[model samples]
Target: MTPSLLEALHWSTMDISGAEYRGKEVPLLVVPTRYLLKLDTTMISYCDMQRVLFEEEKSAYNQAMQQNICDGKIHPLTSIHHTSTYNSLCKLMEYCLSPAVTTLQDRLKENELRLSMLQEEAKQLEADTQNMRNGSPRRLMNHGAGGKSSPTAQSRHPFSNQGSPRSPSGGSRRRAC
Candidate 1:
């Protein structure tokens, strides 16, 4: 109160009159989280999906084996074969799940570059407007002509007859108020 930079009281300041904190017991509600999660109970799990894909792959291989009676046919149940199948499945899953993050990042970069370019243009236009609002160097130089101003662009400059009378009625100031 006396300009001493005193610290303000916080919630834990129990020494003040009737200032103790009170606890409340509120009933908790079980809010539905369905909106928070993008989950469907009907969707199969990843392991189930992989099992189904493996069954399909095996059926396709069996059909191919029936069609081709070559004795040098490679076995389908090898560990290397399973690895390649899993790798292909994972690649498919990744391709399906990817959200085009790189494309969005590229677009964001382009927009930022455009924004900076527009800001620079705005700055240049602001400077030009300021220069035009005040008297420009060209206008100032043209005002050095004698009292007889030509009826051209130079004579129409804002500072053309600045040193002459400023009023229509007969005030003697150099500039209009």
Candidate 2:
């Protein structure tokens, strides 16, 4: 029996001495609680009784239930309710989650479309950038006379080549009063 059921039945614990058929001593727990003898017989062993009462394998069941909940096969609170209430809650959850699932699917599709559009825009921008890089030198060369002009021809003062030794005034001049 489950521990809750045992608790509800108000069973008390007592250790009783017993002997095996081979004349060996053994210990037994006497639970002074009314139970259907046939149904309770299977749980009479010490280990089985301890397992049921002390909850040593509690995490196993809890982990299984958690996995079921995550897989959407069972509701988290289903164990706490009767079969009828649990069925009703399951139906209610289905009803509530249906629209939420639909909304999520719609949003996913919208995001995919937006992402594809952005990707296409990025590709176009990359192509434009490549074309700009390829054509820039030719454009710069053509900006002056068909790419034939010397570099100094594009300077702000083409006639004032200042690197020569000749000064602009040809000779030093005295200041006049």
* TM-score winner: 2
Which pairs clash (backbone N, Cα, C closer than 3 Å) in model 2? none
The global C-alpha lDDT for each of the candidates, from Candidate 1 onward, is: 0.58, 0.54
Instruction: Give each prediction's root-mean-square deviation over alpha carbons.
Output: 22.8, 25.9
Residue 81, candidate 1: alpha-carbon lDDT: 60
Residue 142 displacement (Å), model 1: 9.9
Using lDDT as the measure, the top candidate is 1
| lDDT string, candidate 2, 10-125, tens digits | 64332223433566779988875565354235424533544454343455446655666655668746655444554565566557556656766787899999999778666755
Provide the TM-score for each candidate, comma-separated.
0.26, 0.32
Residue pairs in clash, model 1: none
List residue ranges in candidate 2 displaced over 4 A: 1-81, 137-177
